[model samples]
Target: MTELLNLFIVFAKIGVCTFGGGYAMVPILERELAEKRGWAESTELLDWYAISQAMPGIIAVNVATFFGCKRRGVIGGIVATLGMVFPSFVIILAIAAVLNNFADVPQVKSAFAGIRACVVVMIITTVLRLWKTSVADRPAIAIFVPIFALSAFTGVPLALLIVASGVAGVAIGAVRQGRGK
Candidate 1:
């Protein structure tokens, strides 16, 4: 019971504070789960994020579920997911009700503009942090550069790109292993 409450509190805190969505949550997750609580390592958190991205759902929820299950099994996953989602759900509902009434308010418009700018900055920070780990070597760059260009420039689906990247990673690993042996 205590463990469940703690998990709920921790995830609720993260979910409530997180803005700009999943990538922006990465640093906060690292701080709370890895550095503060010792619940997970940085690498493990990264792995969760990667896997969560590949899965067909919201990345933040997926990460919460993964970590919750890792810590306390299936029920924990449910608790954590609810913790992460509940605050957002309530907030969004309240905002929807209010924003509809104040759609033309200058203060609201300015506030949203400011938030969008902050979101952009947060995303850039996330990209830089992810780059250090993801594009560490030549092969990583090889895989990253082309797909990045294609994703940015063309009409290719992100899921397809993710699959292609995974395949390339596997093929690279296998080839490296074969060479070593």
Candidate 2:
């Protein structure tokens, strides 16, 4: 019970604070769960982030669920997921109730614009940090460049790109392993 409450509080803080979405939440999770609390390592959090992004549903909630399940069981997953989602649900409901009146206000508009800018910066920082660790060799670079370009320019589906990249990585790894034998 105590652990469940702690999980809820930790994820609730994450839920309330994170602005842009899953990518934006990564750094905060790294700092709070990994660096401060020692719940998991930064690399483990990044892996969960990747998995959560690939899976359906909200990334933040997915990561929280994964952590919770890993820590305890189904109940932990439930608590963590609720913790992560509860704040957003309440906040959005409140915002929806009030946004129509304030949506046009210049200050509100400016504040949102500033928030978007910050989200962009946060996403870029997270991607750069992940890239430093995830993309290490030429084969990975080869897979990354065209996928990035296609995702940026073309209308190719991101899921397909991710799967293709995974397949390419597996093939590269297998070939390298065979050569070493």
Candidate 3:
């Protein structure tokens, strides 16, 4: 189908453009899916991000599958996943083939250093963009602070933190309903 081909091309573009990983893909995903394509809204993309993180795969691939499945069906999911992966597969292969020769070159080293810095900026942009929507109130702040602290400072597992945050949100919502305020 024409739609399927479009989906594949779009995902392939995303795959080629994203650099630092899933977190780094947030801005690009937001722009492409929400701003340009209208396939999903920003909040919906955030939901997909959360759900994908809890699932058993790379976040970008899982998110692509989610988008594809939503757009078409199971087959779309498969196509989108392949589209999202194929570019990275080829790029990594190429990089590996030449890394030994170029790894020590000053220009290559400087370029990688620059990329790492940009990746950090991109990640920060994602956090800032999501911050207003995610930590909007006192209860959210209450949940976020401790979770963030544990994540940054402790050896506590990430899955446990995610679970703890979910539980906290549920409990907070239930208590708020009980008080009727």
Candidate 4:
């Protein structure tokens, strides 16, 4: 019960504090859970982030669920998810109640612009870190470049691309192994 409360409080703090959604939450998570709590390393958290993104739900909730389950069990996952969403639920209600009146104010607009800028920087930093770790070899780069291009410039569905890339990577690894090198 005490551990469950602690999990709720921590995830609630993370929920209320994070802006720009899941992508922006990565660095914050790295600092809190990874560096400070020492529950996981930054790279390990990144792996969870990747898996969470691929899951069919909100990434933040998925991440919280992952951490919670890892810590305790299914009940912990439920508690953590509720904690992670509670703040956002209240905040959105409050914002929606007041935002219409101030939506056009120059000050509010400027503040939003600043927030967007910060979010972009956070996202870019995470992406760069992911790239550094993920695209380390020629085979990985070969997979990344075309996938990036297709995702960026073409109408290719990402699920297909991901599947194809997985197959390609496995095939490449098998070929290398067969060559005894």
Candidate 5:
């Protein structure tokens, strides 16, 4: 019961205060879950973040579900997801009521513009942080560079890229193992 409440509160705070979407929430999530609360290790959090991105639904919500389930169980997943989504639901509803008028307001428009800049910075920070951990060795670099280039230049579907990368990783691992044997 206490754990569930804590999960709800923590995720709710994250959802409410975060100005951008899932990518922008990464740094905050890392700070709270990995550093402050010690709910997960930094590497574990990153792994969950990657998996969440590959799965269906919103990345932040999926991450919350993964963390909650790891901490408590299925019920915790439910609680955390609800907590994360509730704020956006309420805020969007409220905004919908006055969005037409609010959209044209100079102050609101300016605030949104500032927020967009901040969100870009937050996303870049998240990318750098993840890269620090992920790009540790030659194999990782070998896989990452070409995939990045292909995705950037050709706009390959992300799912297909991920699948190809996974297959390559497995093949490389198998070759290494065979060599050792």
Candidate 6:
């Protein structure tokens, strides 16, 4: 009971404070879940983040579900997910009510522009932090380079790339195991 309440409050705070969606929430998630509460280790959180990105639905929601389940099972997952999404739901509803009125205001427009810039920075920071943790070994680098190139230059879909990478990883692991045997 107590754990569920804590999960709800923490995720609600995250959802309320973060303005730029999932990427913007990453730093806050890391700080609260890893550093402040010690709910998860930094490396584990990074791993969860990576997996969340690859999974269906929003990254933030998926991460919250993962953490919640880890901490308090299926009920916890529900509580955490609701907590993370509730704020956005309320905020969007409120915004919808007054957005038309505020849309033409120059000050509001300028503030939005500033927020967008900050969002970009937050996303870049998340990318750099993830890269440091994810691209450590030779096999990861080997897989990352070509996939990155293909995605950057060609029009390869991210889902397809991730699938291909998974296949490659499995094959490489099999080969290594065979050699050791």
Question: Candidate 6, residues 5-122: lDDT per residue as tens digits?
Answer: 9899999998886876676887788778887888887678766766776788888888889988999998998899999999989877888987757667999889988988887887
Clashes of 2: 0
Residue 79 error, candidate 2, Å:
1.3
| TM-score between model 2 and native | 0.85
lDDT of each: 0.86, 0.83, 0.85, 0.82, 0.85, 0.83
> Considering TM-score, where higher is better, how would the candidates rank from best to worst?
5, 3, 2, 1, 6, 4
Superposed model 5: Cα runs more than 4 Å off: none
Off by over 4 Å in 3: 96-102
Q: Model 5: per-residue lDDT, tens digit, 31-145?
A: 8898798888878876786677667888888989999899999999999999999898997888898675767899998999998888788778777887878778899899989
For each candidate, give its TM-score against the true structure: 0.83, 0.85, 0.87, 0.80, 0.88, 0.82
Error of 3 at 30 (Å): 1.0
TM-score of 1: 0.83
Global CA lDDT of candidate 2, please? 0.83
lDDT value, candidate 4, whole model: 0.82
Tens-digit lDDT track of model 4 for 29-62: 7777877888766667766765765568888999
lDDT of 3 by residue, 1-181 (tens): 9999988898999998788789788888888888898998777777787777777889999999999998999999999999899898987798898765757899988988898898788778877887888788999899888987997999997777777778888999899999996
Q: Taking the tens digit of each residue's C-alpha lDDT, what string does model 1 give over 96-134?
A: 987675648899879878877886776677668768876
Best by lDDT: 1
Higher-ranked by lDDT: 1 or 2: 1
Residue 122 error, candidate 2, Å: 1.9
Candidate 5 lowest-lDDT run of ten = 46-55
lDDT of 2 by residue, 1-181 (tens): 8989999999999888788777778877877887799988767886676566567887778899889998889899999999989898997788888776767899988998998888788778877876876777889799879988998999997767777877888999999999999
**Model 4 spans > 4 angstroms off:** 96-102
Q: Please identify model 1 stretches exceeding 4 Å from their true place.
A: 96-99, 102-104
